[model samples]
Target chain A: MNRTWALYKKEVRSYFVSPLFYVVAAVFLSLCGFFFYSDLNFFLQFGFGMDIIGNFFQLLFADMSRAMLITVPLLTMRLFAEERKLGTIELLFTYPLREREVYAGKFCAAATVFLVMLGATLLYPIHLYTVQPYAFTVVAAGYCGLLLLGLMFIGVGLFVSSLTDSQVVAGVGSVGLLFLLWSASWNEASGSDRVMGVVKAFSTFEHFSNFSKGLIDSTDVLYFVFVVVFFTNLTLRSLESRRWRGRR
Target chain B: MIEVRNLRKQFGSTVAVNDVSFRVQTGEIIGLLGPNGSGKTTIMRILTGFFPPTAGTAWVGGLSVEADSIAVRRLIGYLPESVVLYPDIPVARYLRFCGEVKDLTGNKLRERIEAVIEAVGLGEVRHREIGKLSKGYRQRVGLAQALIAEPALLILDEPTVGLDPSQVIEIRNLIRNLRGQSTILLSTHILHEVSLACDRVIIIHRGDIIAEDTAEGLNRRVQGVFQTLVRVDGPLPEVVGALRSLPGVDEVIEDAVPSDAATRLRIVSREGEPVRKAIARAIVDRGWSLIEVSPIQLTLEDLFVRLVRQQPSGH
Candidate 1:
């Protein structure tokens, strides 16, 4: 197969082989299940007079996004950091493959595993589907938003992982950066209108809101794409800088 | 094939490699000999396209390392010092992974993997986790990983550093078997390893290419630091003065093992000067029975120390 695909397979298999993957996935799934149950329970309790279905999804996805913002770093912390700490990045960099291929392969691999983790939460919706009819279009839109948001988070996480050989540092740095990106607009009211607008536009939380409401904005889609591409490019350059730093 | 032109690498103020240049013909095994911190690893890194030189250029397989690094990397199979493998990955699977990264696939990848596995004598442990293997086995696996891609140039930095004596011989034999297949540039301070395995030795001291010659040629070059043990049947002071007065002779040190009849003198010659003929003649002229006059054959170890001592401090 393709070389990038080979790396992707190795990365994916690596996750399954390590206990860290199972622990992280199990904890993430348990949290999601608890949130899904709470959302469903609230819908069942206070549903006689309100848009319970919409409320259920709004809470579910928002919680999923926040949980995933935290979870992405845990999964991605080992991508480049572990390879570097183990000195296997030397092997990877010595290969004929371009730097971008390595970054893309790793990003795609982590995204794939993230998708698998996200896929587990689909059981909740599947259960909901069997009980009461929900708008398929709306669910698709929410998923598109969730996938894009997760991709951006993965890109950022991977980039952070490239900066250090310590996985803990990558993990903590990614969480802090993701939190900043997610809440950049939180204090915008005190700023000038133009500054507030810029902050809101930059905030991932702001961009993701429309998607959770089943609205597909091309601007939001482009924003996520931009984040992924930008961070992946940075990761490519990060690998190049390693040469200057005499890491090999 | 490799050619480096006036390469220089500076890490901040400390110059790691200084104005070093060399060429290697295809299929020649060149041993890069250097003391620790002698910049051998840095040079290998530059050649392998792991990093660009702070100045100068290198071409591997006719591809410029700076402009065509990916292509240069394609032609090189590099085993860095202390080969690090993924602890969790099995040897066979890891090799296959590396092969695939080199764009090998299908039947060719499988065949090459099999070949390198047997070549490195890692067939038995191919299915074991790399972390669990012995150092020698891990080293073999490292070699197999580099060999799997079948590149035109193989750059191995201290491939046998931590192995036992028998393992060292095994790895040396493995490298020997690879001759004529790929141009191999291996770096090590292990002198005997160069003498046994390399066609030529490039001695780098203080980030400089102090000497480059065949193993025998290097021995001869160090032979310039002339030291010979002479046993003469004569008055000790007379023999010492006559040997010291001889042309090209620098000093005459008497052996501490006091001899009753024969005077054992260690004659050291001036640099780049051979004093054997003069010392032999002087002893004959003095009517002393020249029992023995043999130029000390400097082992690579002594040669390394002698060369190192001749150079000023690196810093």
Candidate 2:
């Protein structure tokens, strides 16, 4: 377990040093910060001493989660893809660690980096608090929702990364899937019964809307948990399949 | 320290390792000799639990590799072919990560890293990123990572691959110095490496194990004849007759045509059974003078060539 922790630290360190993390984090945060600043002018009309947490989260969380849907893949893409490309996957699998342990290490690493990236945006909320104190409970719930969504996205990205040696393929492929899932929840896009079925099973944006409003529905929680578990299990299988498949 | 029985590995339709079997005793240095695509790497992978054998079993430190893959991995240090490494990581950091996975921590891990760096002569480039290092230094990094655990079994696939002659010698001496502390099974196409470093050899060719024995033993088996060239100043037929009648003589091969007053005869004696003393005495006993007699010894290269060139059973 300590080695697993060590492996997790190593993976996180690898990400911290990689340009991909900085590029994604900087781009995502600056874009979000610009939008958040623009929204702040309009939000101040609600007046002082009012608990604007409800309205504050409703306006910002949707775009933040959508932004994360695209950028999380960039952070997770190199987790296993680069290892496979360099043939260091052989070194990893042949270690005393189990397949699931390796999977957990990578997943936790991407989650840690994602958490840190998301944590930087806490400045926007803190800026709102300095002006006038607001109800902290809804803001906390909204953050929990973003964390859940971010973790699920990381899991999906990690799974996609496991299937390819090309980081480009992994990043593009996971981004494509997550964006498709987010778009499927649109009102007019679900016109077809087939699209409705997809929306029912995998629509991440629809489940996240309730969390942005600070209502932690069990169904929404379960959906995020299910997606995380499903993709993580798939990644574990992908790791095991290497031993069955020929060559590195 | 290592035992493989009837191991077979197939990459789809192509069989890479076909029912191969060999063992490495504790403190023994064994060479897995073969050319490219000869299943040497496959066997090492299977032994290291990198992948399961399509069919067969292997034991490392008395634990089944398939059944106790994790435990087996803990007992061994493996250097894969090409020694694929993360280019971005510095040498010390890479070894520290390797040491960590084996449950080493704190001062113990630091000291082990220092020890392996010293052992593999990687102290100079320990702080450099692996990608920036040259081939020989990269090799030392690889070797250092493998040696970090001081494992009971060290499975190396082409340990000296792509290194210059001097680097090869340095890597070899590094391995040679760990003789009694760890058992090693290294694969190499270089024949002299086997002769100089390995106590025993298991030769594989085309996915099949062709021969397994000590270097000298394989040499004797392949030769099966200890040849000695004899030059005598007497009748050719008479000399041949006398030499053929000597003890342990397999047959008499005429080396070349008779020159002037002397004739050359190559005496084929049973392998590893010396007939030189008898041949010398017999030549001098008679009035015929003994001009020359020298035994031709076969090298590991010759044995390797002979073994691979020969056909496999039921092939």
Write one digit per residue (lDDT tens) for candidate 2, span A1-248. 87788789889888877787888999889878976876566567763344465555677887788778778999988888999999988988788989888888888888898899999999988877886677767877888899999998898899999999999999999999888877776775646988687676678888888888888999999999999999989988888887778656
TM-score of each: 0.87, 0.87
Model 1, span B102-137: residue lDDT tens: 889999999999999988888788899999999999
- Return the TM-score for chain B, candidate 1: 0.77
**What number of clashing residue pairs does each candidate have, in the order they appear?**
0, 0
lDDT of each: 0.87, 0.85
Per-prediction fnat values?
0.77, 0.72
In model 1, which regions exceed 4 Å deviation?
A: B225-297, B312-315
Steric clash count of candidate 1: 0
Across residues A1-248, which tens digit of lDDT does each residue of candidate 1 receive?
A: 38788888889889889999888889889889999999878878886456744778888999889889778899999999999999988888778877888887888888888899999889988888888877868888888999999999999999999999999999999999999999989886769999889888888999999898889999999999999888988888888996677864
Model 2 misplacement above 4 A: A42-56, A187-198, B227-302, B312-314
Task: Please report how far candidate 2 places residue A126 from its true position, in Å.
Answer: 0.5
Clashes by residue pair, model 1: none
